[model samples]
Target: MAHGDITHIDIPVSDMARATAFYSGLFGWNIAEMPGFEGYPMWQAPNNISGGGLAPRDDGFEQPRSYVEVDSIDDTIVAAEAAGGSVARAKAPITETSAWAVIVDPDGNHIGLFEGVVGG
Candidate 1:
């Protein structure tokens, strides 16, 4: 994925099955539970390029958020802080080769930053 491009999205839901059914029927998305992430089902858009996950609404993530691909999560975090944004979640590994971080912008919008590619 290119830097600054929306690489993924996380949609907070109260009921995973219900939300999955609705989204799949409405948009024909391919939603399925990943092997390592059983409870959190991931979805691929009809176009097959864009994808996201359906996570339960929780304390830190109570709303939907999009993830932007970046060259380096640490660098992006620094830049975001310099631009008046605050880190919501420090960099955390998503997989052996991939990681993510959450940041709240100056306008209070939550955004995710993704770095590296799984198995890339």
Candidate 2:
């Protein structure tokens, strides 16, 4: 499968409101509350070059991880596994069109693969 650029990042926060306010006030970012994303508040930068959302961690995800963009998350996961990597989070659909997954590289480095859909 073809590869895409890393389009977004996800930040794990214990307090969504606090994190949102901090980033918004500090960097003057436009942070919005997106209920459609399972209460994950999203932060969008002014230039729109870099952005991500804040999700509450409940599954032992103590640290935040960076997400890498790819054409097909399944293919990336397969390649990662073949390269002696492990799947931290299986491929899961974010919406009808987009999908994402977390995997550990050969060196146990956490990496995220994100696939953006046309309408997502």
lDDT top scorer:
1
TM, every model: 0.95, 0.87
The TM-score measured for candidate 1 stands at 0.95
Candidate 2, which segments miss by more than 4 Å at Cα? 1-4
Model 1 per-residue lDDT tens digits across residues 29-102: 99998778889999999899999999999888888999999999999999999999999999999899999999
For model 2, what is the C-alpha lDDT against the true structure?
Answer: 0.80
Residue 118: error of model 1 in Å? Answer: 1.7
Q: Which stretches in model 1 have alpha-carbon errors above 4 Å?
A: none
lDDT of each: 0.93, 0.80
Positional deviation of 89 in candidate 1, in angstroms?
Answer: 0.6
